[model samples]
Target: MTYTVNCSILLTELPLLERPAAAKTAGFDAVEFWWPFETSVPTDVEVARFENAIADAGVQLTGLNFNAGDMPGGDRGLLSWPAHSTEFQDNIDVVAGIGERLGCKAFNALYGNRIDGESAERQDALGAENLAKAAAGVARIGGTVLLESVSGAPNYPLLKARDALDVIARVRTESGAENIRFLADFYHLAVNGEDIAAVIEKHAQDFGHIQIADSPGRGAPGTGQLPLGEWIARSRALGYEGYIGLEYKEPAETAFSWAIRA
Candidate 1:
């Protein structure tokens, strides 16, 4: 029943070193972030600084996500598109190597969104093929990638847990990459009106890391509709051994910055 904080909250305010420091202040022993390689790009010295922060704060690096563009006008789905390009494989290998060196075993491989004029089945096949390639690349470096689901109901079509699982199954069947798994996010699950606890229990075998934030506002634990603590307890009860990632927005005030309940 341990927890980790996402570095996205303090990214703009704190530098890399200070981000872990803040997490420790907030009573977390580990932290995760969304693609820190560029924004908080870690040089050798900077990586050393981050290592010191982890040691000083007694925090571990939970997971790190590679950038997948889902911004407006960008077609960001990784598996939903072709992934065999030499460029894509090279990028995955490079980042995955970095992740392994940093002692981070888990990374998020987000399939951004479905591109226009692509049939549903076509996108699914493309996404699976690309993801399997990326998974193979990541597995070579002793790291695992989590296929995250995004639900863009009012926008482009999103990938659900079932879709992510399907991709995982396909990769296992076709390429047999053992490292790739699922990053079950509560916020996105709630957005799609899925059963949070049930999903965790049913898909525990495929899950590598888990993330949480209350529904509706996507704010801190108790501020919104989702029963975060209950869900956490269920995961724990189901024998989840990975870190629970807190990927949520903080209140405007600094005082509420790291406040977490349950």
Candidate 2:
């Protein structure tokens, strides 16, 4: 598999509008992000500006996330949150618009963590409903809904490979469509105590998108314990053919070095 830089995590030192170009200069042909704007409801002009940036930069947008509120502030996701259901729905068209415009084929729909007083069943129902809508929209463009796991926050519900796959199964059943698939982020899985090798052997076919970072520090590969190159080989060995998103923290200048594993 080749590499696609996740601009949201890498090149943090550059302006948002410039990250795609930076990724390109770093030798990446594709990139991903977690909602580039504070609100998923960016104006048409704003969206157009981003589109132009990518065009001018000459990089393919591989994936994007639905608005998840404040990622750095511990907001796990928006769709599954009862209060943010409308917000999540409102962002769907905007997301799909950009995806269609950019020819991006992957979308990550995070399952919101539990609200203080809300029941899991209620939130879960909302997640299913919202994801069904999202799946239908992306399916129009032949894109896939990525069920991903997040780590570094205890409240985030989907932290394991099985956790993400279970949610994917539930969404598929509810939507009655097969456009949804697993987004296997190796860093999160390892930190959550999953055996990466075993997960790959069993669920490789379910993975529509894959991301990586070394665990323990969520830093550049050499700064952590994961044998990312070996695991990537394991993934390819099992019939997985997809871009591996470089999702980790590193100096923008040195970030591309980790792509050696790709």
Candidate 3:
């Protein structure tokens, strides 16, 4: 089993480029992140800075997210948001370029929250179209595109495991690319009231990536009530062979061994 830290959430005390090394300091060989910069269009210099960070830190960029507008302000993803379609297009190559340089093979395309005044049907249509479009580029790069659920945000379309699986199926059909897959974040599923084992028992094959954060507080495994170790064991038993992303609030003391071994 491989465990990858999510720098966008953990090790955030450092600059964007510096976070990779911080993850390494915490004993992680693989790291993933949200779009490092705010803009969908960052200059070549900025892109290079990010590339060098990962290289110098000696860690792999296992997974990445395409630009999703202002993440802190609740812009979950741009692919589905109509106002950001041009920005999303402008960002595809930039993101793909980063993945190519790192030899990373997974990309997470967040389906954005609903926009005001736009009908849900139209937004859903736009989301499917954009998902298909992103799928083509990701496939060309020999990588799989991921769709994940977010917690507490009803406006975000992919809030449930079933919801994400639906989009995965639609994107595969819409693009004729079977490379699309589900990103199963157990914390989000638990937050949304889905039974984890049931999701795995039924659709384990649909999950391309899995992330864990204990429920009640989205903290490290030992700090909460979630049976993450058990869940991880179950997922492996179900034949989930993907990376387990460590995406949660940093504990007061960064403990690394158990998470990796689990």
Candidate 4:
């Protein structure tokens, strides 16, 4: 299983571009960011600086979580948010252009908390329609829009894997867009009682990328219940050759050297 690190956890002390060196030092081959646009919004000079940083560190840009306009404290949602539907495609166009410039090929669309008055069916329909629109634009840039399911609870909605699967299948079928897929995060699966490997196998075609954090604490893979090596083996057996993103918080250590085989 090839490994990539999300720079959000490590190098929290510096700019996004500077995180690559620390990521490389910690033995990662690729790096991902939640929202690079926030740090340097709409400026090619800053974008160029980030591109140079990746080039210098020799790390590939795995993917980016699309800017949901929350990094600046404006809102914690994306185009999937009903309020932003009209401007959603234009927003995607801007981000897709940035993705094209940076060589990243994947993006995430996470639906936040539920609307107070909407029924489950209405929300799902809106989500499918908006995501399908975004996916069409994403495909033009040779990137994919992955609909991520966070555990639904007091704090979030659309937390169920079955719900996300339904939306993805319906949208793909309706839009006839093929590049859209699912981003399975083990942390959410652990919270929602879904078997990680079972879900992957069940939705083989929709599975595109993965992120992992051990259950109970959302720590490094081996730090909790997840069997890292076995998962690696199973993923390969299942014909998954994409990046397995390491997105967990380290308590005190700079690298997960114990969990990773040298």
Candidate 5:
């Protein structure tokens, strides 16, 4: 099985720019990341430095997240938020530029948490619109836009494979953008009470990318009760031939021990 390190969550012991090289040295040829910049439109120099870090490290950036506003501050994403619509739209080119430069084709777009005053119906509509725009932005490279179901954020709406797929279907029907797809992150799904085996059996082919950590503590595979190796095997058996992102939270030094054991 091919694995890609998620530098944003794992490898936190090192500076952001250094994680790609660290991951490369740790025996991974591919990596993925959440938005690394503080702003949606970072200076060109900043973008170059980020691009160069991955290039210098000789690791392929297999997947990336479009700027989901203030992740550390609890902003899940900008897609459905009315106030941040411009910010989200402004980010599309920058994201596409990075993807173009690094040969990364999969872009994950987090659906924003539901606002207190905003109607759920309106938010869903806005999210679909922004997702279509994102789909169009990366269409030049034949790239895919990913929608994910997240856990732990109480206000965030997407909590199941069906939820994400519903948005994807809306994007396809409303905008005629065929490039949007589901990002199947097993840890979040399991935490949200999804049946991993059933999801794999039914929608494995619909997944544009896959991310994993064990459930409960969201630690390395062995730290939780999830049968990660078996789940991965089932996904592959169902024809999921893509990078499985190692997006767990654990000390970097010991993170890959589970892989060694497997």
Candidate 6:
């Protein structure tokens, strides 16, 4: 029943380096983020500053995303894209180094959107290879690479739980790396029109990490109609012991009011 804040999404008001401390001030002992840097390979000074910020804040980094291409510009991730395979491969060590220093273990690899002319078969093959590389890269720290089902990006593939799970199976089979697992973000699954209760009933214990935001507007728990608390309780009841990441959008001042009320 532990909770972690996703600093990338929740603390948008603060500067990137400052969000870890902000999360600590808001009473979170653990936090997660998408790639904090703009480039796949940031400078040594940049890496040191990022690591130091989290350490200074006294919060544990529980999860992080691989260098997904320009998120605001609509680039979802680099893993499945044929052109950016080099950048994706280059980012593995940088991600693992940060994870090693910060004690973070879960690494989320966003499956990129389909290219205009590239066949789905090519993209799928490249994705599986890149995911295998990422899996091996983080295996040093006993890390697990996470595959997530996403929403809102029309061309982005892997919109359902089974889609991600199928890829996980492919990676394991082709690469023989057993460290890959599912990132069950309830909001996205619900938004994609999946059967949430049925998904949980079948694969609750299979998730490596969990993220939450209410659907329809992606707001905090009470701002939407989603039964977030109940869903989390069901996951825990079924043996999900990982952090419930608060990856919601809300004003920082009142972001946690629903949690406080609960």
**Local distance difference test, each candidate:** 0.68, 0.87, 0.84, 0.71, 0.94, 0.94
- Per-residue alpha-carbon lDDT of candidate 1 for residues 27-102, written as tens digits (9 for 90 to 100): 6678887665442234577556555676677778878776554334454434455442333444576566666766
Better of 1 and 2 by lDDT: 2
- TM-score, cand. 5 vs. native: 0.98
Model 6 ranges with Cα > 4 A deviation: none
The alpha-carbon lDDT assigned to residue 238 of candidate 3 equals 82
Error of 6 at 20 (Å): 0.9
Which model is ahead, 4 or 6, in terms of TM-score? 6
**Residue 75 of candidate 1: its Cα lDDT?**
40
Q: Which regions in candidate 5 have their CA more than 4 angstroms from the true location?
A: none
lDDT of 2 at 121: 88
RMSD of each: 3.6, 1.3, 1.7, 2.8, 0.8, 0.7
List model 5 lDDT by residue over 1-262, tens digit each: 7999999999999999999999989888999999999999999999999999999999999998999998988999999999999999999999999999999999999999999999999999999999999999999987999999999999999999999999999999999999998899999999999998999999987789889998789999889899888888888888889999999999988989888776
lDDT digits (tens) for residues 1-262 of candidate 4: 5778888765667667788987887777798877666531457776678678887998888887766665434343455556666655556776677678767898887654566676756766777787887788778878998877775345356566776677778988988877878887778777887777677667644577888887778777667777655655676677767888888877426456654554
Model 2 lDDT at residue 26 = 77
| Window of ten residues with lowest summed lDDT in model 2 | 253-262
> For candidate 2, what is the TM-score?
0.96
- Which structure is stronger by TM-score: 2 or 4? 2
* Tens digit of per-residue lDDT, candidate 2, span 1-262: 5789898989999988899999888788999988988786998888999899998999999999989899878897899998899999999888999999999989998888889899988988888889889999888998888888887788888888888788778887777978989888999889888888999989887789889888788888878889888888888888889999989988876776755654
Deviation of model 1 at 197, angstroms = 2.8
* TM-scores of the models, in the order given: 0.81, 0.96, 0.95, 0.86, 0.98, 0.99
Instruction: In candidate 3, list every pair of residues with a backbone clash.
Output: none
- Model 4, position 35: C-alpha lDDT score: 65
Residue 134 CA displacement from its true place in model 3, Å: 0.6
Model 5, 152: alpha-carbon shift in Å?
A: 0.1
Task: Write the residue-wise lDDT of candidate 6 on 1-262 in tens digits.
Answer: 5789999999899998899999898888999999999899999999999999999999999999999999999999999898999999999999999999999999999999999999999999999999999999999999999999999999989999999999999999999999999999999999999898888889999889999999789999978878998989999899889999999999989999887787
